[model samples]
Target: MILKRLIFALLIIFSFTSCTSDDDASTPDRRSIEDLETDFQALNLQQGINDVTLENLNGSSWNFRVIIPESASSTERPLVLTLHGAAGGDVDAHKNTACYAEPGFAALDPIIVSPNGGTQLWNSAFNQDLVIGLMYLTQKYLNVDRDRTVVTGYSNGGNGSWFYAEIYPEIFTASIPMASSYSTFSSNGSVRTIETPLYVIHGENDELFPLAETQEWVAATRDAGTNVTLEVAPGLTHYESCNYSPYLQNAASWLQDEVWD
Candidate 1:
């Protein structure tokens, strides 16, 4: 009888161990994409600058900044992703100071997102994927109005804006690229016909990116059934074109007319 009891106890122990092992194996290794997307929707974001890091689907991470206006609400608001020049600058320079101080844009009270492209031009496939992922996160978590999402950038960022708008035509409501022009990045049917109206802002006297290239690219995009408009600053240089507050306001107004109207 004692021997029989010992054997039965060993059998029970082995069965339990096997079942536990199987249960552990059945558990998921990672969160679903849908769940991950909405995971931060309830995040408590404060007004002003909030530096944060987000993980993209490909297991890569992005360090970006978000600027929330003081008058921000829980209701849906417009979201603008501003790309910096080749300088790899921070968000405070782009959002709180330059953009918020602008007239029309300040009144619009949109949430501004500026990403760190890490000292490189915004030309990487990883950056491209991160940008799209950032937009998805912002719209889902930050109360962004999906229909009013816009993109604008200066110099390198400007090139990024044009490139992204072409590749992901359905992602944005409008695109404004300052002191930049189209390149092989957006050419050769690499990007679909831009569904969003694109406003190309360049300095006629720009020495870095030639004005001739800007006009030619704009014309080609127009020929490809894209509703594009080019605005040239008469005497402004590439740097001045980005800092000219009035022109930034004008771009904001044009975006408002296109989507908010």
Candidate 2:
């Protein structure tokens, strides 16, 4: 009887293991980039917003937000790359706050590309690679005007705008940095080498990044012969400076009339 019981227990265990293996085999695998591309092709990409995930050569991935206006189907529109602050790891928040969010990047009528920073700061080799890859993808797939590409961001994102503008000035036409100062670049006049115009916006009463530092940096950059415009919002703080969708339209207009001139 004992021998019979042992054989029955072994049979039950083997049956359970086989069932588990079958279950594992039945589960579907994750979709590949090809699958995603196929899905994207089916969408009406000329209107509304799309949240995209793209894989890089290093097998890493990028999650970004793309805003395609109604004009994208017929017109080669300008592209604005908006970076995010230290708040989050994804582009969701930045997508909601960038020039493409609610007011519609209005008069600018540009395609907005906002990417996740992946880190708290923006000065990294991984981020640089990601930006280059993203730019390539945008140029190849989207109706992006390469000559009029703009880079803008707030806080930490603003720091990225300044850093990338200095490093890759050839790709960008102008930069709008809000409540940010030179992060990796110092006052050694290195920013003077930038050919792209800069519009520096800040709050007068910011406690995190004081307006005084920004003033000094802008003064130094200007002294270095870099074309720059400074706009200060009176009685505003570092946190308050992010309310920009309403005011950025004017800034975009200025870029069209002044900087791109």
Candidate 3:
């Protein structure tokens, strides 16, 4: 029995020593420039889109999906921001996106940001920190091409498209807000003064939002000194964005054509 107790005591001492050795030292996360550069080179961003989260002013968190195209290079690549509606959250809309989602993005590569609406509302109020939080989070990871930033959204997301674009016209090149309408002004309630390109799409048969909204958005943008294009899909309903099927395809193509410009 004595020998057994001694053996157990020895085992306990050895275990404690091993654990203490590990606890005695902690490594800092700081890395040298050369080390970081080496790590960056070893990293592969070609794994398609990724998931990211950010904290909001309300102490809540938001999720987003990022898609990077194979054609995208380290150079200034255009970034696409796709917003979701109130009923569906970020994940749902991210999956529904024609190109950034499944079989669509499996081939074509474009940087897409699908963010979760905190309250499912666009929160156009300049007081809200959502836009600033987004800009910070975006700059933190991916190298977004600011000069070519584009915003698009459906339903409530459409509000966000207009809110973000109008607020930061200098940061965005074009905006496509589908099936929705805004007051046609920047965040500060000032009329749009810059010349950001815009493409508006709406279904004439839309019941949730009148098809006339498409025309209204275009008119407002043009009147505000912004270049605008309008497309009204016939026989389409508000909830059913079937018309946007081709619209999304063209959106990708059109953006691709101008990414370099």
Local distance difference test scores for all models: 0.68, 0.69, 0.57
Model 1, residue 245: C-alpha shift (Å):
2.5
The ten-residue window of minimal lDDT in model 1 covers: 1-10
Clashing pairs in 3: 69-109, 206-238
Model 2 lDDT per residue over 174-223, tens place: 88888796743446635454567888888888899998888888877777
For candidate 3, lDDT tens digit of each residue in 11-49? 443343234344434733332323422433344445466
Name the better of 1 and 2 by TM-score. Answer: 2
Using lDDT as the measure, the top candidate is: 2
What lDDT does model 2 reach?
0.69
Flag the better candidate by lDDT, 1 or 2: 2
Best by TM-score: 2
- Give RMSD to native, each candidate: 14.0, 15.4, 16.0
TM-scores of all predicted structures: 0.75, 0.77, 0.66
Clashing pairs in 1: none
Off by over 4 Å in 1: 1-43, 55-60, 87-104, 184-192
Residue pairs in candidate 2 whose N, alpha carbon or C atoms collide under 3 angstroms: none
TM-score of 2: 0.77
Q: How many residue pairs clash in each candidate?
A: 0, 0, 2
Whole-model lDDT, candidate 1? Answer: 0.68
